[model samples]
Target: MSEGHENAGWRRLFGGDDLTFGTGFPLTGTRESRPDVDEEMRLAAHAEDLGFDALWARDVPLYWPRFGDAGQTFDPWTWLSHVAAHTDEVALGTASVVLPLRHPLHVAKSAASLDHLSGGRLVLGVATGDRDPEFDAFGLDHEARGARFREAVDCLRTVWSEEFPAASGEWGELDGDLDLVPKPTTETVPLLPTGRSRQSMEWLGDHGDGWLFYHLPDDTLDSYLDRWREAAGEKPYAMVVRTELADDPAADPEPRHQGYRAGSEWFVDYFRRLEEMGVDHVLVGADGDDPERGLTRLAETVVERV
Candidate 1:
């Protein structure tokens, strides 16, 4: 791994198949009537104890009928704080907080609070929200989100860094002294840009600490990484893959989201190929409804193989 990648806890926690395995918190599902919030926290903490690297939550403020993933069942920021107190080692990240939906001041304050409380284990992934229902609910113009998102990013970085930085933009204003107390333990928190979010390639290169993307073919992966290297200069890269595990290692893969349904053997080969391709981190979503069993199987049969 490169020095920049090495310095981020994500590299240590999610670098290779040997030590890098993460299990996501399933907030929205038909499995059970919203398993108690406290119970959810305990399960996530248990994943850390079980040797998982990170636990990711989603920012689904309101369930859009079209995008029907209930999404981790809670307000992302408050849930992160509650989970941070219960777990000691597992890193916390949001799949992405729609940057334009919320106030940057609130976003900066909550993020810094979690970073401080967790001892610098927060990895923030942000995006310009896409769902129309959400945009409507907040009375924000969907078409203008990209511009708003760019502005929000600027405000967040400034609010967290400057003792009293003056920010004037389309979003709002931050005039006068603003401490934005408890700056991240690291000079700045690690940020991963998701789905373009209206940022130009050059802008991403200069500002983004990392990139978050969905799965891609090996060749496409290489191509994107090359572009990222150009923009990233020396930053690391990360992505998400949603796969389904079969009951038997010999079971063939079936199509899931960017990932495939596969056996332990296939999963092992998949990650080995990813590592060889220079992918620093791969966030795996639980394959099935029974996340515990799926995670345990991956840990025992696949990760152990590495």
Candidate 2:
């Protein structure tokens, strides 16, 4: 795998050149304003049973009507705790927790607890947060998010690795006074920065264990890989793809937002191309009407066959 990601859940999932697959939470359609917890849990367990490498949950602390997506309608930490109790092996990840929105100490403590509880299966994907209203609602200066993001990353790492009283700028200084309990099973939890997090590629490469980005076209993806390799040599790169599997196995590809609508045959070939391009892992979302059936078909055909 990569240099710094040796003991990470991400490395376990995307270690070699095999190009593994994972599925996003709320596998159901986006039109449903709220998610059914029971159904989601069943589907999550089923996805793991179907041989998916990871199960991702998003951190949407508040539902914004304008954003139009409720993001599984649960707290990521709480929900993942629930998932950890039920599943034995599937990796659990936060498709990204907004670091700038929450206090870094809380994030560090909660993340560490989850990592220990889940037997060291936490890969934290963090971001600067995109929703403008959320920043306003939190009474934070949205413009300063980039700076806060960097600080939070530093703070999280310090609290997780150092003894109490560690001095962290803006996150507050601990003078050997108190400690954050339940450190991650490993020395540090894997941190994958999503979409630059308002920082430069150099900064990301230096700090992030991996990169979690949205889907890109083939040519765009190749170019991205080139830049990422230059900035962070051999670090894993993961993307999310919205997939709608057609009934006919021979269907052609149709472009959707960041992904495609296609049949199993096309998907297998497409993923092969992704593997060839050095893409590490693909997070698949079943975008069809029946999420359960869609995920089952994807597993039986594209996921399993590929």
What C-alpha RMSD separates each model from the true structure? 2.7, 1.6
Model 2 residue runs over 4 Å out of place are 2-8, 30-32
Give lDDT for model 2: 0.85
Model 1 Cα lDDT, one tens digit per residue, 127-212: 88778788889998889987888788888788776887888787677686656887776666677788677778777777777777
Deviation from native of the Cα of residue 135 in model 1, angstroms: 0.9
Per-residue accuracy of model 2 over 1-306 as CA lDDT, tens digit each? 544444547565876669889988876655336777778888888888888888899998788888887787889999899888877788889989999999999999999999989888889999999898999899999999999999999988887888775576765777788999987887788999999799999999989888999999889889999999999998889898988887889999999987898989999999989888988888998776777787888888998877
> Clashes in candidate 2: how many?
3
In angstroms, how far off is 171's CA in candidate 1? 2.3
Candidate 1 colliding pairs: 27-72, 253-261
lDDT per model vs. reference: 0.74, 0.85
Model 1 lDDT vs. the true structure? 0.74
Name the top TM-score candidate. 2
